[model samples]
Target: MISPRAPRADRRPVVRSHHGRSFTDDYEWLRDKSSPDVVAHLEAENEWTAHETSHLAPLADAIFDEIKSRTLETDLSVPVRKGDHWYFTRTVEGSSYGVFCRAPVASPDDWVPPAVDPAQTLPGEEVLLDANVEAEGHDFFSLGTFDVSPDGRSLLWGVDTEGDERYTLRIVDLASRAVSDVDVIPNTAAGAMFSPDGAFVFYCTVDDAWRPDTVWRHAVGSSSGADVTVFTEPDDRFWVGVGRTRSRKYIVVEVGSKITSEVHLLDAADPMGEFAVVWPRVEGVEYDVEHVVLAGEDRLLITHNDGAENFEVVDVAAADPRGLRDVVVPASTDTRIDGVDAFAGHVVVSYRRDALTRVGILPLSGGIAAGGVLRVGEIVGYGALTELEFDEPLFDVGVSSNPEWTQPTLRLGFTSFVTPSTVLSVDVATRETTVLKRMPVLGGYRSEDYAQARDWATAADGTRVPISLVWKPGAVDESAPAPTLLYGYGSYEASMDPSFSIARLSLLDRGILFAIAHVRGGGELGRHWYDDGKTLTKRNTFTDFVAVGEHLVASGRSRPDGLVAEGRSAGGLLVGAAVNLAPDLFAGVLAGVPFVDALTSILDPELPLTVIEWDEWGDPLHDPAVYDYMSSYSPYENVRSDVGYPPILAVTSLNDTRVLYVEPAKWVAKLREVGAPALLKIEMQAGHGGVSGRYDAWRERAFEYAWVIDTATRGARDDLESSAPVAPTLDA
Candidate 1:
């Protein structure tokens, strides 16, 4: 219990550059975050991580009261009908946010979500936004556009009291709960929607590098300085957005990056008009879109990737918008599609086959259906379609709230690693289903008292990978290696499926195991496992998460002295490049908000979203072979000051503008200038999905599950030393 003296961080060099090299950063003066000597070195690394883990404040308050007693502190969510209302969200038991409600639709074709007891608040509901009374006097709040409108009597939302992902917007009214003095608007960028006669709203706005690159429109009660701009995206690797078309009939707008996409459509009943595109940014081709209604016309479907490297669904013709054709032609397990919704009777789709997450259901009645044909022995949206069966062999499903394009019902949402997320509804013309809720985990939780499987690993170029796990099954000994905690994030093609976690049942009720590697820059196993782990085959996402921590220490399910790796934000650059490729195969890592100074934020094009992440970390300014492959694995330029590395921590968020609390305050000041065992906390009023209520995110997940179970059972020492400290010094 001693180790305190930490905050050194003063080095100030700063040279940088790209294409024609140049380097020397020395914690680039902690990127001057409004310097009071960089907020006194991040408040002295938050008071030396609160006097070195103030003895895991009673195991982070008994893992934050066993995640607030298996959470269901007054619940609700699962209503969602839309137009004669029903919506839902509620949360109230000592609330720290939730409320957005709705109600009035027990009839006019009511799609049943009311067997009542949603914390007993339904008959005449309404609420529409109360996020703890709009997060009273903020210390980081968040929300970002809750949308409503289309005659639900205006709502739009947005807010953010701190945690810098911009936000603000407003316009409330919903039958006099009043709040609109000329709409408000400010900063922006997290989508906003409405138009289709909810009288204009659109939203988005970010350039100066924060990247949402202009969208605008406004009008509602007007005065965001007369809004307008409608669409801008002058390609800084594309980034603009706008929504509509859950068949409220077109208005999309899109534009993309991280490998091509373009979309654009507009006419949600022509709100101040002008939008068109439907497909035009093809460098590495990617697509998305939904609007259906076939045979009664108006089409679009899309899902694309022209050559179908695991993407196909075609359609086109929002009145022959351009005649593309096919209709779900590509998946022989080359799955990966990921989205498509449409309805007035069927569609769902979502993809990703063998690495799990499915969805299916197509049905636009097989006849001539506008000839956007799935012809040749049609079998519906592919993986032999009509899907929904889920008995868990590694679970995670999707298509959650089907917003009525003439709803026949869809909802769904399942989960796995020991189930508990549930939510069902189904019946898109009798594929039946209907559970309607399952997340009431409260103490007596059991999915057979935990245990999950699926394995794999291999990789040093021979690929394989997979992993998933979870534990408490015989607590530990099926012949050794226990204190695990593998986890990984891979990146952008997201997929980290197998859900469930009442704060991971306080680390599987203490014997701690938890896994999930599923590597290759993520889309689970499709799109060539995220194109072989990103640009220049980005060190195969840190050698496939160091080949699953050396195949969880060669299958004894982890114990290269009890592993302990983690990831966040691009899987914290995949465990900061698998701790410089394998710091003696981990003992503790975490990382959170971590995009570890990737070659000085991808050779800085004015930073934020760095030129739309040049399609996922590649254009290193002007490519000197992407500035030597992002300065050879940029975890703050491959931290090596005489290696002895391991024990890291580093969660961050000084209002993170997406991975920028100066990349983990310069990778924990270069892992405390090489003496290793770094710590750094920082959230100082949150951002980048850090703390915005729920008891400061359940005491930041009980201080990272009490430091990944005290660094995987107290760092069995391979010089990845651990002077036992698990967490403290938190405020904001």
Candidate 2:
């Protein structure tokens, strides 16, 4: 493995013009000295370079080659079945293309090909989708959940190119073995359900700003048919999107930005018509709506967070447009509900209490005053709900930790770091799950010795910010220093949880400590936590992350010289600010696909993602105070040559649309010119995500961890030598 290049020992620290001044004073002086026009010109040039390099056609091809070479030994995709037979997909070598239903895992631990004949078992053998599978190409492909129609005549799959947020809907005619590409829409297709009559398909679309736009109905066999917009925003200030119910009679629409929301109900059959606002926005409250199901005509079971105490499920009948009465599940103040799934006469409600989440079942006929709740099982993590068949005897529930469901008999498949993926059958009534086939695990690894730790740090403002650490046991010492890597993405109410990982294990086993700072501007601690770290309060997130680092050092878990910070996209903003505020705290910084040019990024509302992000970062142009605050800490605008700074490795993709590759490119150029030790690496074949294939991803991570370890270890070695005590030895 290639180690990071160390700084020269003879390179004495340069004494600049400003010395002995506070960081604030140094910042002001640096800003006054740099010409604004020069900064703008550099930014423009960087943007041009990003655009030109991104259009190079060979980039994606090269990336695909890298992905294939690394992941070829492993079976990355698994075969799944909705009907009698099985189907699978896999990418070919030296190509960015994949073939479907070519390989099938007959049983667990069976590495050799099955004795069964392939011609009889395989369905529509190996079809080509994308000929050129470059990560940066416009036609890059992604494999989503397969939705087979009730009669098994057609199958619907979603494809996204370069994580564009928008997806192209495709349909495969099972009978003819032909594929047809549908209209492109903004929102990703989470669930594609065919109408009972099979005349149209219902899917959701999000706007360019990343807000849910409307649920659309597309007629089959028509290229230019009128698209019925089922859900739409009630006002320009708020965004609206709809979710499907099991019965297909009620469509739930949620409206609001980050701080507030209202749940509305509309007849699924006639969704284009005006909807009856079910839950009105409550003042001074921030909440979310989910698990909306239709119990009967004009009656619905709705789960909502009113910001009072916790989320609760209310059984309400839409008798009056403005009034709704609780029926089975009453509103509660202490217990929080996560999800609700209605089947037969029982409603399965998922709730969280005392940091533990579980599912409970309750019968609908029982009144709210007497309905009994029966605890089912502990929820290891949030799982997706799939409708097996319309009005079938049983429906399938996809959950982690249930391995039996991966078998061919169960017909459902799931993927994780340790688990390749397996199909399974689940009995809803008995809650019995069986594995069909275990997808082969790739790479030489196991997930047994890794662990996750949740801790808190007291911020400068006396607020407690939650931080999650994941690593192998004995990776770090409380009394000795070690290479510590801290990661954070504190923006947009995005929660960074302690999830399973295989690639991360590569770092942990190598004696590196990886941690995630769950600071404000995230929904980890609920609404209040997110509210405290967004807009003008965004600075709180930076301070909170710094406090976590300080806690780690003060507690003897790690030293400042052993620390390296990493963040991406919006999190990139956090890394830039944290480094500027306390350069001495980190030995190396990795800002990958970062948005360092915050002020300029927000200035152009016409950009693909700026308008929606305004709700999170605040509109600096509209508010002069916001502009002043943002300008004060904006990474590109805050660079100073008078102050010493840590070495940085800035990584970016030429085709990233969300953060834009130009942001990091411009920041790196500015920092380098200003005498900061920074290196820029542009992945010619990737987009926002540095790499696509599993093996390629692991290699990228390896490079990152190696850089961090070398920097931190080298710093420790230097410190030890400088502080060594003088000793006298007898001559021999």
For each candidate in turn, the TM-score is: 0.31, 0.71
**Worst 10-residue stretch by lDDT in candidate 2?**
24-33
TM-score (C-alpha, index-matched) for candidate 2 = 0.71
**Against the true structure, what is every candidate's RMSD?**
25.7, 9.6
lDDT of 2 by residue, 653-724 (tens): 655667776677667666765677776666644667666655456556656655666666767789889899
Candidate 1, 1-732: lDDT as tens digits: 766698888787878765567888888777778989899889989899887788888998999988987787888777878789888888878788888788888687778778668657777886777789778887878877787887888788888788888888888787887888888988898878788788888888888888897888888877999888978988788887888778777778788888888888877777787888876677988888888765676777787776878777776677665675756545444557777787876677777677888776777776423222122235333223465667768998888777778877788888897888888987866678978888888868778877798888889778788888888775666576778888888767788888897888888777778888888877888888887777788788888888888878876766765688888888888888788878888887988888888877777788788878877767877778877987888888888886788788888888888788888888888778889988989888888899988888988889888978887887445334556565676762
Residue pairs in collision within model 1: 145-158, 317-320, 559-562, 568-572
Cα misplacement distance, residue 96 of candidate 2 (Å): 6.6
TM value for model 1: 0.31
Q: Model 2, residue 412: what's the lDDT?
A: 36
